[model samples]
Target: MPEDPGLPAGWQADSVDGDAPAEVERLTELLRAHERAARGWASGSEEDVLVEVHGLETRENVVVRDDTGTIRAWGSVHDRAEGRMLYVHIVDRTLADDVATRCSDVLFAWAEAQARQVGAERGLEVQQIDTGAFADDERQHAWLERAGFTCVRTWWQMSRSVEPEEVELVAYPEAWSRDGVEFRLVRREAGGLPDEADLRAVHEVLEGAFTDHFNSAEETFQEFIHRLREDPGHRWDHWWLALVDGEPAGALVGTVSESSQGPDGSYVSYLGVLDTARGRGVAKGLLHTIIADAAARGRDRVGLEVDADSPTGADGLYTAMGWGTKYVTESWHREVPVS
Candidate 1:
């Protein structure tokens, strides 16, 4: 057993500033290689790394380097919500088993420390550290399990190709009404920013919609807006709110996807319909709005992730809407008591 949880003997660990072009390139390459090994494709990019590590206020990152000054592993923790801390773990597959295991220990320890700090700051009794892995990646599964994390859920990463003609086929009126339900983009103010009231409505609708969902936690308005704005692809117009009989009932938040291997796309970052608005076509209407918006923007596809064991049977709806699962991912979580 290693005496130090942070690093093994002869290894050096340091906080990453998320600057230094060479360091960023190396990290991006490491991410790409890992993704390719796990899923047969690479989607990691320099921009993604920057976004993940740059927001030091709400995130912390560390890098493990060998004696040769080569980075062998990377870890990041995001204070995702009041009681949840999101973790990112990446290790070089080329390293020896013992070395890789030690790297995992270091990253896991760092994440646990960050989680506890967040919990203490929020005055919580416990904090959940949430991490994810490719479903088919046995290495990640072993690492997570060995670190006392449990596989909590599986998600289907689904995608649907967009046809240009869909812009004409799908009606995307600014404020359309059907069956007493209205769908429209969140209103903008005179300064070109989204209306505060509309934004709050979207947040409240999502919060209410996910109240009964698995692993749901309370996220403050400030945290919600700050985290979403951190994404490089975030756009004001991609946010849509649904009103059922003039009451906020649902919301859909979409983001642009910049792909290096193919044309850019659109991703449904979030879609939530309040329980009171279920079965009213609110969800379907929101989906159509984003699809039409993607088509108008010439995006090749629209992608979204659905919980495999969702009580709402959302996967079925996505499948029926022409979306197909392209890959699968699993969530792993470990809870630590705040000290």
Candidate 2:
């Protein structure tokens, strides 16, 4: 009797299973390699980098191999309900021609099935699959479009090279001061988390600030905390909070990301000002604080991504601060029912 050929003669698919240490190590190594390759190719982290594949609430990996048993490509699905999102984080095809097409077909089919499973579990009618490709990555973009995804939003990967002398002149806007309003950079205390109350205040400010923006998902307090904790670079000291009339009004959350694909350095992960606080220059003030902090920390550069079409015209603010657009990426969204 001959050995059974899995999925015809030239193709094989396998489901990645088990949480064994070896399995986790293999997945992490694969993910890191994928990330490095993507950064080398695209100048930044892969949009779908899966940092915690083993701990994802819902995930499935499909590996396609050739007749020689060498893995050619893999895909994965991660489902999160807090934001009511189903993210297809991994879809890579190293094979060429029919083999690649076949692998993609199997991958997307698995993703759709996973989405259906999530819907069944949550009693929702539909779920979204969000993906992005570097502006230079036309091939991936084409693959996504051909797979029924559409580009809905674009983001700019912006950066400002650190020059201490240049940054010294980048003063916090003094013209828009509010009486009794104060600004402070968060600092780490011995074995202490950032003041929880201060963090909550910043969360409230962010929620109120971005309410009208595109795909502005309303994050619960817990969700905000969960997200910050998940990031490998999250640091409380890098955060800044603004108070208007002694009340919290705006904030900037900064962190050091290995994802920058540049020198290890601080990045302004988010910058926001509440609607009522916008005209007071709080956003600029917060940004100035973060940039100065990054420079003082000996960081090579400070980077951030912004919606190209932000209503507040944030890109202009960043540009004025010496940041230049390094690259662009488009977000592809598929609408699915909320319920």
Best by TM-score: 1
The lDDT for every candidate, in the order shown, is 0.89, 0.65
Candidate 2 residue-wise lDDT, 1-339, digit = tens: 013422447767675544555544454545555444454443223222344444354455666556776555566655543334545443343445565565666666666665666666767776777666666655566667777878888899898887665345334422123345567865446677677777888888888888888877676787677766666678777778888887789888888856444557678887878877767777777776776666666667889999997777888988998899877778886654445
Compute the lDDT for candidate 2. Answer: 0.65
Q: Total backbone clashes of model 2?
A: 1
TM-score, every prediction: 0.96, 0.81
Please list all clashing residue pairs in model 2, or write none if there are none: 124-339
lDDT of candidate 1 over 1-339, digit per residue (tens)? 235654566787777757788889889988998899899899888988998879888988988988777888999889998888999999998988888888888888888888888999999999999999999999999999998999999999999999988876446635577888988999999999999999999899989999989899899999899999989889998999999888999999999999877789999999999988899999998888888888888888999999999989998899999999999999999999998
Model 1: which ten-residue window has the lowest total lDDT?
Answer: 1-10
> Which numbered prediction scores highest in lDDT against the true structure?
1
